[model samples]
Target: MSSSALDVQIKSLPNQPGVYQYFDSEEKILYVGKAKNIKKRVSSYFTKQHDYGKTKVLVKKIASIKHIVVNTETDALLLENNLIKKYQPRYNVLLKDDKSYPWICIKKERFPRVFSTRRVFKDGSEYFGPYTSMKTVKTLLELIKGLYQLRTCNYHLSEQKINSRKYKVCLEYHLGNCKGACEGLETEASYHKNIESIRDILKGNFKSSLQQFKTQMKNFAESMQFEDAQRIKEKIEVLENYQAKSTVVNPKISNVDVFSIVSDESYGYINFLQLAYGSIIRSHTLEIKKKLDETEEELLTLGVTEIRQRFNSQSKEVYLPIPLDLGENLKITIPKLGDKKHILDLSKRNAMYYRMDRLKQIKITDPDRHANRIMAQMKADLRLTEEPRHIECFDNSNIQGTNPVAACVVFKNGKPSKRDYRHFNIKTVEGPDDFASMEEVVYRRYKRLLDEEQNLPQLIIIDGGKGQLSSALKSLEVLNLRGKIAIIGIAKRLEELFYPDDPIPLYLDKKSETLKIIQQLRNEAHRFGIEHHRNRRSKGALQTELENIPGIGEQTIVELMKQFKSVKRISKATKTELTEVIGNSRAQKIINYYNKE
Candidate 1:
């Protein structure tokens, strides 16, 4: 379709809450999204300039537009989720259908048997969860078993089978683990009562169960049944201990969903925490690859909808680090302090840890992907127009104005290229003038690279404040390479980064990866420069001292150094030892020089 035809379809969209789908020229769905006003949202795509390349591409490929108008935003969100799942649009966040998660199933029978399963059926049975891990499912099952006497076998306990004596009690019954519902030893009413308590326990409501157990223990003690009372006491303790371990905040905060997000340039990680009676019962972190550089709010909204639907959660309230409009049916609370803030922080930490672990795994398994992510992150963090794949950092080292020198360190793909490291002695500058030394080295390094037709670094770093950065920039200007390469300076006092022609410095977070890499480069350059300076100083000191000696030529000093290693060692050497290494006359001259000192 032409631009006119596309504009006509966008103009015809209604002004209401709905979902919209974008289709490419080949009639394939490219994206699915929801909006409060369909016309305004659709038109903004055409009017605004998008920074992300993918969003621009998506806009250009829009051959057609389709939409479904809804009465409210909640309906729109639901419809959008369904449409995305149905079509699996390329530009939408990927929401996995977690069919592999474990669930606790209560079978639809006369006496229900509870067990964990990976599959769900539409047989009218109750399934409690689709937990994130098998360990959590197992722990829940064990807790229920320790507190209640429930059947674990698959035997059908129909009235006809029980009346005909078709089944016998299993070993579980003799072990005091089951109530023998198969053999009719446990009444149906009593068994259903235990089932009700188990259901409540699974819902993370332990109050009723604890009350009932305390009452039973009190009755057993009154009847002088010491063993039964002791068993009941043990069960109570077990339940209490489990609850204490699970609860993270005040028990008054119940049946709410907590969500927090951590994002980078390419993906967003959202962590969901399902709380019941102030205990965290469910946790899941979703990784969403960004197709259009989506913001945290957009990803969080979509993530909450998808996660809640997948887990079959009917939570009326939610806690978030940021406030969002998720329809009027759900109450969204942004926690500022107290227990709510603590839980939100916990969720945020979970998201951060998940992101860290995922990046570490990707670094080992797919290094290219990891490098791309770091480059993109650095580009954004430094506000560069392009990724700094090749970078060079320059540092000047001079102690008390004595052997002034500069070092250049190269980094390719955010790692040090040790083979590309170079050192320079400041020949044009007189004293420890850092600015002059920096200007001289920067000019020489790039002049040589340009002369030899070698590849130039995308970025240049100066290990000083604004003064050194300006000095480096002047070289770029003289070489007619100004504005062709990015240059910045790092101050050693506070790790502040100075950009060319910018007075205000960029202060990255102390723990940010970009800052760490910049610091690494600065430190490496400083160390390299200091090492070269120390070597030059020591060599210069040795030459000046020995060259001043009378009748001590270069060859004689070389012969003595070959044997004694240093001037101090040669001076300390015995006459016989010196004669063996060098000639006797030169050896005596070296000994006389040191003896006068």
Candidate 2:
């Protein structure tokens, strides 16, 4: 952070606890943090050099500071968390998910049906969870089915319906799968009791279900029903196995929400774990894209709100890796060590895995959005006024001076726009003069766009050093577009960026997205131009071969070429066909010349 900017912000900084945000010159939030003493903590950033490369880059980008004052340190923490969640600054961690997690819902019909779903309806029904994975929901459902004979059918089992005998027992009843509640073979009281037991099991409370199964097994064995006793014992084992997968943390740390964050250069992932009686009832990770520079706290805060909102979280307390303000009523804990810390670490690990998964998903599902992010990063890196959404790059291909040509390759949104690509044959330039050829092609390209009033590119890239860039500038000057469009040149040797009048070149990081896109443009333009140049040279050679013939006039050659496309095709032509194309006088001469050869 610059001292000039800090000097002013620190003077107004409150001695009390609060959240602070850093912003660049464009006023985009870079990072969000909480401090007991806003002045002291923020001052520490400018006073010393940071060891981390990311931190140093962040400090240099900081143009201004903003803070929100609060009463206690806890309040500051809460506010910081809220802000981080809200803005999701680039330096802060971010978690984002557009869809809600799958939940196990017990429909509120007569003889409620249990199933897994991702939607949350307001109709009166019991919803077990917004589980992190559908696999978990499927496993729990299988366990419940094994433990108790629940109806899978969606039939109305009201007393009037059952008495009317309107519904018949399906295959499930005959297969010993259901209790035949539709025929009233099993009473509503018994069905409700089983459902209640399943509810407890979904909440990670397996005690009641286990005890009931054990009692049933003991009674069956005592009554000499060995087969029923064995079946009941199997059900007990299944329920226990399901419970064992969960119940990893200390059970006493009940009803606590744990959140942790992991981030990359362009994105952040935050994982949320909902614990009920020391078992993870629900766990999920959210993916977020960083707009500027966000911190871990900011990302976690945002993830918490999104996860809570999507899954309909009502937990009042949340455990996080760092202290921050989420709200006045919500309790926030930052564990120093022990079980809580272990759980927090586990949350961070989930976030890390989620980040990797999302990166792969993005490359496949939404490549356009990924390209936009890369373009936005380039815009910021280049200090360009606008994103280079539509870029046009020019390369001159005057190889060996045989047939001078140039190519203009267009990129609409960080990908090649082949239809808009153009090749020039250097109409106004002579010899191996690249500067003159560049001036002519650039003028022709834009002059037509001006006459037609067509769209212009946000940026123009010249595929050489300052010499080529300056020559292109002259045409822009003639067209009165010197300042209207942003232009730069890339030197091939060192990949240096050159501005119009600036002597010093800006060297972007070799791994930066901006540099990558520029290299793509340069390579594409060179490729496009070289292809056009080769075609022109081959075509010229074919025409020039006929020019070597004696007494072959220009008009006669034109007539022959119009009839025959290639030299090979013309040589294959009969005397009659040649006479028809160029008439008897030239055709006989041409045939005689070829016959002599």
Candidate 3:
């Protein structure tokens, strides 16, 4: 929090655009910000008589600061947003709800039925939503039903026909809304034709499809088909009205993931706008923890890298918040004027609004206490030359010599670096030997690190005691990586820690903030390792059983796996269900063979 410390930190920063963070002594982030010029933006905080009412009060508690320089202002904006979501800082505006949004689920039946749901399970179907507004999804569904004259009744058509009295037309039929299928006035071909029209509308081709419907209505009117023309006219009006209400943000660009970051002193918000074929698809908001004295550019860079690492795809062309320095090398663009500007402006406004809402919800006055304590403890206990900027942990998992897997999780300044998480399928190790698996994983991981000439972890924590520690040390020695990395082993005895080499494992007092943080990191690595192991084991078992079936080649097995996800599910499926997924002959063979017992 000293001016001298601030000056020292500023000397190391680049003059480029980026996002920055202010961290307390315990390494808890206090504020996040974005900057056009890292040096100027960060230095402004230390100047005397600056507009430092709230920031001045918060800055007094600051222990340290970190930054990430990006190629452009827009990239800084994105990075800032991503960081806010990752570390919900106390001073920034944040969105509270983390619930999954509702989506429209279409059951994979012979005749697919659409329904609105917030929950998505491993069921055989397709989901298309997470729509920002439920009203939009409902209106579209209603419009499709009106135009297509598809079945809206929940009762099964065949059951209704078989169990009920001789078929009688419903009210929709009388109103010309049913297509007269109940009265047998229309053939299956005519009904299916209407269904196809509905499908087109749902796919967002409303303009062209509506025009065709209008032409048909006119032709019917010219032919003196009064009732038919009236029906078609009504459907066309419905489509036009629906289109009129829907706001079009951009018509030129399709399938874009728009991002905007809003931050103040303590926290930030990253708003992700998903557009599909020039239409708004959905929006997601994430919160970030703020750093005290870091520049905006550094924060934004970190945010973008994290977002890109977590969510970017080859199919996406990222839009920028400001002009980038990467120039023509990257596909980032800052809109100067016109519709693109309008879109970016809208995104910025949304982010700002979210920030305001978040600021209002913050109740804490001084949020750096916990972070400072943890950092202090870590420094004292680890006997480090400097504070640990990046800590890496390793854990291995397997079940009785089957499907062994290892995971390496990275923590940069006391938080998980999801982008740096690595998983290894135990290849060099043959059995359930956790020690050997740990050794192989450790060797391969560090060997790659050496080959890539990357930074080494400040502290490496293994999940087991003496044996595991010995194995890791042996691997490091064999790979000529022994002296380059700092390593430790953490063994858990019920609720206690047993450290290797040290006769007494270091255990912080239960009330200590540092203990909680270290425990979180260790547990996360363990959870990650176990999850990876289970996934590999499950996939291996399924693939082995599936490959044994005759005529069920790898491709077919893959298809079946993609559809059903598990061998147990596939085994439980009926011939009819299997046929629907993989055709009749294969389904019959699978059903007969699997059920033969």
Candidate 4:
């Protein structure tokens, strides 16, 4: 941490227990630590001997340090936990798990059946695993179903109508594997006994069960029971076939993870894989360049440590992309030939492709090239006196004639400055009048800029024709901002560009790069504006419904609506909970009215 920043911050700190945070220039928290003596513990980082390795790197980037004094060490510890959970600092140990893993579930029914599922919800079923791969889980379920002759039908055994003609035996009965309990062809006791045997097999007693079946087959053959012997022989064959097909790539390399990093000058990607019984159980591609500030080697080291901390380990064999002297039992190699090389090559290719595909999906083009072309063209077309550096766009959205709203989005050097984006909930305009709504939004947005003495944008783009352009210009004039800013309106059809005084809009050639750049900006503004409007309108509609409730007038309704944001949420609140918002008597009345309804 910067000594000056730490010194300035520590001056205000009380000589009490608390948690402190060190932040880098990018506003990212570099480290979070708690101490009994808040000032002394935080100041230790500024001392000369403490500056080395990760700490040295952290200290160099430190722009500011902050401290929060607490009542006691326990309070500091609790606050530290909450901060760690919230910020998830890069240096901290984080647990990791694949969010979309599949599981095998057996429903709680009279004749319980096993099935593969990806989703887990609040249903009374016995669930096993978070299997790494859906295909692997599905294959296992198929093998179990084939061997046990379990019912694959959706109908629960208890829900199935007893003594009904619809309960006919399926194909499994024809193979003599199924005890035909479906049609009352076999006693319930015998069917349940078979199900219990299946449950044992599912619990991974395949070897013991197979041996027992083989022994039974031999005894039947010796007693000249050909039919029974044949049945047992078939069961043994199924088990043997499964064992043969389930080949382990490396028996020694069970339950491990492998990670690799690939990067160019500007960006890097981390490729990770989880293995079980030497098979790739799960794979992940993480885009790490956006979060990293270190070199390739530092990123590799940090990535390995971070991932290891994040995930559980069953084995010591963690494969790496490059060799490091961590003194662990990890096998670090850069394979040049053979199966290991092939797998490594596959991982590298996957990482590269993943990075490329992500970049393409996001339409991440060179900002400098596009920005330069657009700025040049805009100055020439709009007859501006100077090049536009900061551009602001306005757009309005609503449904039919309800909850009209507008959005103001800012772009600094062709990238959105999200922190500066503003939204206006059409207060002055009541209905779906786009021109009037646009005027209100523009007026409110620039009024703040003037009031705050903030820098005005060199260019303003509105998503409409001449009417919208005139409204925007009028708003600027009312605020005495005209001539201080250059403005144009973009229309969707024919890709027309209109000015406030122009009677006819100008259409740029479709092939022009400048036109494409402007179109991208205009579309982005529209998308952002529409999204905010929809959210505000939805919330407003919900709030209006809260106001309609008995004993809930506008003011109480506003507080309740602002507190909970929805009718469904308000419905779940009790009288005491409602009292926390308004008061005891009013809360009771509101609760009673809702209860009665």
Model 3 residue runs over 4 Å out of place are 1-99, 121-124, 155-177, 180-200, 291-315, 323-331, 360-597
Top-lDDT structure, candidate number: 1
Give the better candidate number (1 or 4) by TM-score: 1
lDDT of 2 by residue, 382-454 (tens): 7788888889999999899879999999998888999999998888777999889899999999999999999
What's the TM for model 2? 0.57
TM-score of structure candidate 1: 0.94
lDDT at residue 516 of model 4 (Cα atoms): 67
Which regions of candidate 4 deviate over 4 angstroms? Answer: 1-5, 8-98, 106-112, 121-133, 151-248, 266-272, 295-317, 321-597
Candidate 1 lDDT over 328-353, as tens digits, reads 98999999999999999999999999
Question: Which should have the higher TM-score, number 2 or number 4?
Answer: 2
| Candidate 2 local Cα displacement, residue 458, angstroms | 3.6
Q: Give the clash total for candidate 1.
A: 0
**Candidate with maximal TM-score:** 1
How far off is residue 395 in model 3, in Å?
65
C-alpha TM-scores of all predictions: 0.94, 0.57, 0.41, 0.39
Backbone clashes in candidate 3 total 48
lDDT of 4 by residue, 420-484 (tens): 88777889886689888888888989898889999999889998888889888889999998888
lDDT of 1 at 48: 97
Tens-digit per-residue lDDT, 483-585, candidate 3? 5666777767632444435676666567444556567778988899888888887777876787778888878888898999878899999888899989999
Candidate 4's C-alpha lDDT?
0.69
